[model samples]
Target: MTTATRSTGDDERSAGNDDRPAGRAGARGVLSAYLALTKPRVIELLLITTIPAMFLAERGIPSLLLVLVTLVGGAMAAGSANTLNCVADSDIDAVMDRTKSRPLVSYRVPRTHALVFGVVLSVASFAVLWAGANLLAAALALSATLFYVFIYTLVLKRRTSQNIVWGGAAGCMPVLVGWAAVSGTVEWPAVVMFAVVFLWTPPHFWSLAMKYRADYERAGVPMLPVVATPRQVSARILVYTWATVASTLLLIPVTSWIYVGCAVVIGAAFLVMAQRLHQGVRRGRGVNPMRLFHLSNSYLSVLFLALAVDAAIGLPVLG
Candidate 1:
């Protein structure tokens, strides 16, 4: 071949290799963006609550298929809700460091595309739960999605400091949905499970809100930390933590002594952490509050997982 032709071919080959990496990177980026829209951390906590609720509802092994369907449906519904939230909050999200990189906020994904994806997933999740699980579970899931997307995100989030307090109902519904998916009914035990999560939400969220009060202030969203003085937020966190610990103990009557024991230990630890956070905030120290926030996340996961393990071992939680 001519030297010129050889040089051109080599350059073309090099360019192809360069383009390949960029193409692969772009594909990976798209996947990461979509997964972020699902808000996997939120979904994980939601599923943790659902699993314990199922075990508390049925003392024995529940249908694995039903559990599987409920998980998938819940995940899809949650993802859709979160995606729509991002779409709705894109304006404010752009200004918040924690949320600035979200697909909708960053324009990595177009708002219209995200809207369509959210709608499709939301509808599909409801249909899947209805077909693969049961009508009650499906309806509950749908209600939760609507509550988060409309009530929490679009309405309460930007309007009031009580946002997490009332908005928490949406997060709490997964327990009812999971329970009904298995037994096709709601009962006191399910209600107890719901209450545990409902109460847990406020303190859990408030901790993070405290850490990001400035961002919330900048966004003009009335999160508790943004509206309340630090002392007030800390006081409320301790109050809610106390309530959560109490609710955890209430499960003792409905679940196994093993679960009750686990609850006591975890709840005590949670209280200690919360109390420290309160003290730190009172003293004008912010670091421990963030530590408490991280601990709270782990606390709920371990606490619920303990219940699931106890149930699986055939411990007499329901009896």
Candidate 2:
């Protein structure tokens, strides 16, 4: 009887040892999968717009603590929206080559778990913004998430070719939120920044759509590149590119000489790239949409960086 009991205890100990490693690995995978649901790269881009708007609102850098709080709140809010978007779009994501490797598609995280995780983050985001920033900032952050989930993901994305153009408004909310966080209100400059992003979105996304046209076609997303001919799409891209450049110049009167100079130089480069894409598409030449797509990312980053720099040291250009 004693020997049999010992054998059973030894078997239990062995089972515990075996289960420990599996538990650790499972925990690690769960953590990684949750992080992927946040879409960190997209969060980075969203925070880029938010930070500079804060600087422009403060007319220099805001306090480090404020910056940290706003960034955390913005990230959580964006992550929440992106996570829910993944859940909603999982059906389409399953078929697209580019998206088939997502956490939901791979089934590393269950749908219900991801949904609950997103809800938790969204609530945390609102609480953080309200506690650390203010009511307006929190409201703006929540609105961005709602607009992204409902307006962009559910309502617009699948139905219309002009989906991105209208849907991009949600992406513009970070600038407004940042401005409100610093100043407790939105202003004309914030509106201009919002417009710049709104204009920049189509060309930015269309380039990716152009590269993944077949993916979108397969998914039935009706992206501009999917619905329009290459020349037509490129032409629209050029129009928006020029409009974005012109919108940046509007900042000259509100900002400074440094911002004006940077705007002119960067806008010139952006317009040139757009022109090249348009000409190439028209001529049936080697048109790399990704080139303009990549440049657009650089363009926005540098432009916002310039805004921050000008706010720090630039003299008045309108004088």
Candidate 3:
């Protein structure tokens, strides 16, 4: 071929190769973005509460299928809520370091697409839980979704420092959903489990807010740490930590000694970490507070797991 012809041919070939990888990467990015919208970590935490709640509500092994269905429904419902939250907060998210790369904010996914996906997922979750589990479970899941999407994200998130405190109720509903899934009704033990998670949410999220207060402030999100001084936030953390511990211990009346012991030890360690975070803030240090945050995560997971184990061993502490 002539020189120009060969150059043109090479350009075409290079363009073809470039297009192939770009297309593949684009597809992968879309898939990953969609999954990110699900808030998998949040769903995992929510699901952790489910198994324990089921155990606390059952004398014998609960229906494995019902547990599975409730988990799936809860995951989908929570994911949908998170996705819609992202869409609604896209503007603020774009300004915050922690949320800057979220699909809605980064334009990795369109707002309309995310909104539609969220609606579809929410509807499907309700259908699945209602048909596969029970109406009570489905209604609770639906209510949780609405609370997160509307009450938490829309009304409370920007309005007050106590946003997560009230919004946390949405997060705690999964325990009731799980319990009702098998028992078809709520019980005192399930209420205790709900209280445990309800009280746990504030300290868990407040520590994270402490670590990212600057981003929250810049985004005008009104998180507790952003609205309050570091010392004030730290004090709140300590207070909430105490409340969380107390609530977890209250589960002893409804759970086995194994769970109670786990809660006490974990709660004590959590309090220590919170105290350390408080001291750091008091001293004008800008520490990450990861110890408190990480410990809180572990505390919840292990506490619920203990309940599951107690159930598996054919023991019912309260029932």
**Candidate number achieving the greatest TM-score relative to the actual structure:** 1
Global lDDT of each model? 0.87, 0.92, 0.87
How high is each candidate's TM-score?
0.95, 0.92, 0.92
Number of colliding residue pairs in each model: 2, 0, 0
- What are the runs in model 1 whose C-alpha is more than 4 Å off? 1-6, 317-319
lDDT of 3 by residue, 266-297 (tens): 87898888888889888888767767888899
lDDT of 1 by residue, 184-249 (tens): 999987888788888898999999998888899999999998988989998999999999889877
For model 3, state the Cα shift of residue 271 in Å. Answer: 1.2
- CA shift of 253, model 3, Å: 2.7
Residue 289 displacement (Å), model 2: 0.4
- lDDT at 131 for candidate 2? 94
Candidate numbers sorted by TM-score from highest down: 1, 2, 3
* Each candidate: RMSD: 2.5, 4.2, 2.6
TM-score of 2: 0.92
> Candidate 1: minimum summed lDDT over ten consecutive residues — where?
310-319
The window of 10 residues in a row where model 3 has the poorest summed lDDT is: 310-319
